[model samples]
Target: MDSFEQLIGKNINEVDLNESKTFFIALLEYDTKHCGKRYPSSKYKLADMDYYDLISFSQLFKKEAILIVWYNMDIITDLEIYYLSNDFDILFNDYYIIKKAIDNGLAHKLTEGDTKYLGASRLNEKVPQPHSDILANKREFVLKKKYLQKIIDEISFSCK
Candidate 1:
């Protein structure tokens, strides 16, 4: 199986979201028992090492389809798939600002509070940023947690 990073330039439809979700869930389950004490700081025993790559890849599509896997006490509980129409005028503007900031060497300064919907979030301190001239931590665009919660709330409300 190709790493999520390898799927960056591919069309969104070409990547099987269900397969990826299944793989991650299995990985988490296995890692929970065997990889004890490996990640002391993580609330969940397992962390997807490719999460930043996955989010970056998702941003390339106009219709960003994300699979949200819910967990309770480290056990998989539910899964919800949501699509963000990135081509909307406001979303496009936000994306453009984020891209411009990165291209302008401000990636290191980007914070989650910088945008209402989307944000450029730091991935790792040592990861090298390709677009910035200044040496900076690698960053990936992500939907703000608050914004994600709002979406989840709406979905939950509608389902009732």
Candidate 2:
């Protein structure tokens, strides 16, 4: 038997990417809902993105499909595609609470955990520890929530 990771497409679901593809992403500090119905077409300075600016960006960028798994360590956000150049209007887009942290910075250490999966350590401080409320409420978000937000596939994006 092969490991799931080794299994050809067994564990793979929606994400689609390749080593040669032009990968671009932003490490945004926000919730899934923050990815609005409209995406930011303007150029963003990835190194220094302000929360307010992000708020504006969020209001515009509605690409994340829906909530898949919103947890402490794996909060997937928006997944979108645009031209590599400054022309942001050209969008090859799809929406899903993405699970990849992407980058285009120069001379930066890139790794699996570094640019994939959303980290909610900042919320842990505020959220009640040993969260009894959450444990008690665990019946699958689908059952409790109005809909079991479906998984979507992006023709242009992929996650490893």
lDDT of 1 by residue, 9-70 (tens): 55322434434422222111112224331111111111221222333323344344555554
CA lDDT of every candidate: 0.46, 0.23
> What TM-score does candidate 1 get on C-alpha atoms?
0.51
* Candidate 2 structure quality by residue, lDDT tens digits, 59-111: 33333332222221233345444323331222112101211111122111222
TM-score, predicted candidate 2 vs. hidden true structure: 0.18
Q: After superposition, how far is residue 22 of candidate 2 from its true place, in Å?
A: 2.6
**Among these predicted structures, which one has the highest lDDT?**
1
